[model samples]
Target chain A: MSGLRRGSVCLGLCLVAALTANAQTDAPSRRSGYHDMGKPLQAMQDDDMANPGMLWVGEGANLWNQRFAAADKSCADCHGAVQSMSGVAARYPAFTAGSDQPVTLEQRINLCRTQNQRADRLADGSRELMALTAVVAHQSRNQPIAPPDDPRLRPFIAAGEALYRLRQGQLNLSCAQCHDDNAGRKLAGVTIPQAHPTGYPIYRLEWQSLGSLKRRLRNCLVGMRAEPYAPDAPEYVQLELFLMDRARGLKLETPGVRP
Target chain B: MGNAVHAEDGLRPYRIVGDAIPAPLTGEAGDPERGRAIVANRRVGMCLRCHSGPFPQERFQGTLAPPLTGAGSRWTEKQLRLRIVDAAQLNRDTIMPPYYRTDGLERVAKGFAGKPILSAEQIEDVVAFLATLKDQ
Candidate 1:
């Protein structure tokens, strides 16, 4: 009877181990290939380094609440509440019919200003745009990055996949060579995090400020000895669409803090 | 700050180059100037960022990756060439980016349409420069 009971206990332990591994690998709404989620790198650090994205979000909240326009309308006037904007950032990099390009959250936010608020489109990389984007991204913290699966974006995703696989520059390195093959390996002193789309618009400690996804992409290209795409380029847009799809079900922690 | 640390103590031969697969090079002779260009070219080699070399134009280089002065003494021309081309093929878990393989890349820059990042000639040139790096 005791031997039978021991066998049963071993089986139970094995089942528990399997379940834990499954939870890690097959967890729905979890970012694919990311090490840690929800917690900012700042929080992970023993020392207190204020998150730059949070700083920008504070500026955005002020801008949202402050009065604007001749009608004295502000972003918060209609949205009034901040939490309603939650989950909004995750659905971005959307398709545009006229341009036939995947529009990023920054472009969409600017479009709202131009169309609804009767305001000029914010210049790309402006402080105001950063603040606005930070606030929107902050709202979507922990929400899965559910890039809308519209048929229009299929071509871009395909293009991005091709780009990810193709070699570039004199060194002849591809994006997949490092991010996919050597991911999670130690390079020099830093651990190579899998190039997942979970923590984007991140505040990199190296940069000492918040940076957009495009910036990171450009950095990768440079690292590969490949010429970087122009800012807001079509190739990058296609790549972003593909990344969003690949990172499907991962939480959007935009304006995220990262080492 | 000093190149001595990178040259003397920074990396072990096994660690810096990683487990690189040995492959036959496709070019005949190497060109150091072309190699220099490849190293400097942001769209090509971009070696100046990581390893300090004969490039006088570059000032700030990475301490994490070792200097490439005595590379030729440490590794043969063919071995250095293969490592430059694809370090990951030898070691499945190497952080060094593979430079020559044409398969499985994403979001290639528009200028590199339908072509490998570098031609066989360029790889030879970079290898030539690496061959010049010997401990004197």
Candidate 2:
């Protein structure tokens, strides 16, 4: 069994090597991740019940009501009915009440757990963290993304735009070269999107798992053969803010499906 | 030959004399067969990411730039070498990444900050493969 597993791993690497040799990764195909997917993936996203990401949504719902032993609290106690939280996620990567640092929903959840419930911070990329973020973001489903307006966020936004345009990696490609400059063309069968941040806790076919927006950003950095920043890195939050700003007024597609 | 130079031979920045770069890219002759593989491979040249070509076997050609077909007829081997080295000289805003040049780029991975994306031999090989793409 171990030998078979090793063989499969080697095959995967060889396939990757073969595919990369034939790559045209520099196109500017700026459609949304949604528009890039095929029919089967689209259908999976349309029906919440059939959407595998909803499984995370389900887990989130359960986490929302469970009491935390640390502070004897649950999200339900303070936030009230989940439905009432609608439109909340739409405005995030926003300036929190106490801190000036803008935060994504994942960061907010960690803050709530540590500050309000006195619970330990959820591990980055942990299943529970994804679940809670999905639950919170799902409340804002179908709402237009409304990233908060505040001058305090200006510096971060500028930094993000700089990062977006700056080329990186051995390929010497930048996000702008593809996402901004060539948003609608194909890159060896994959469509590159304008790279909006409306979808968080997305169900990506490539991952075969639901993940946060930050996770995807890290993937892009890795794809460039560059070292990826950590999940909690300020760059991720700032990039999240900038993307949300660019996608301003576009409807939120939380628990979104992507290929 | 051209494709014979391995990346491990280590890359040195080429002088982009523009309309004057010496051809056969590296000092050696390039193997057209190997050169062709480098252009198609995602791990190396990734030329298809922006340009289309007569690579029928390789599906998903990009439409961002001009097709690679007829390239041999349009540009001399020397010209192709310079452009591939760094097209920024011809068109400052060209989305094409510098396949061989390594200086003056921003936010490069620490280890690759000074290294060209393609080794000198790889560039010669790709140029050789491209030179074969005559308008038929």
The DockQ for candidate 1, computed on C-alphas, is 0.13
Question: What is the C-alpha local distance difference test score of candidate 1?
Answer: 0.68
Across B56-131, the per-residue lDDT of candidate 1 in tens digits comes to 6665553335678899898887678657765655665454555665444444555553454465678878888888
Per-residue lDDT of model 1, residues A82-137, tens digit only: 77789878877887545457788788777667766878788777778888888877
Stretches of candidate 2 off by over 4 Å are: A1-31, B1-15
Candidate 1: CAPRI quality band:
incorrect
Instruction: Give the TM-score of each candidate.
Output: 0.65, 0.85
DockQ numbers for every candidate?
0.13, 0.35
| Model 1 per-residue lDDT at A237 | 76
What lDDT does each candidate get? Answer: 0.68, 0.80
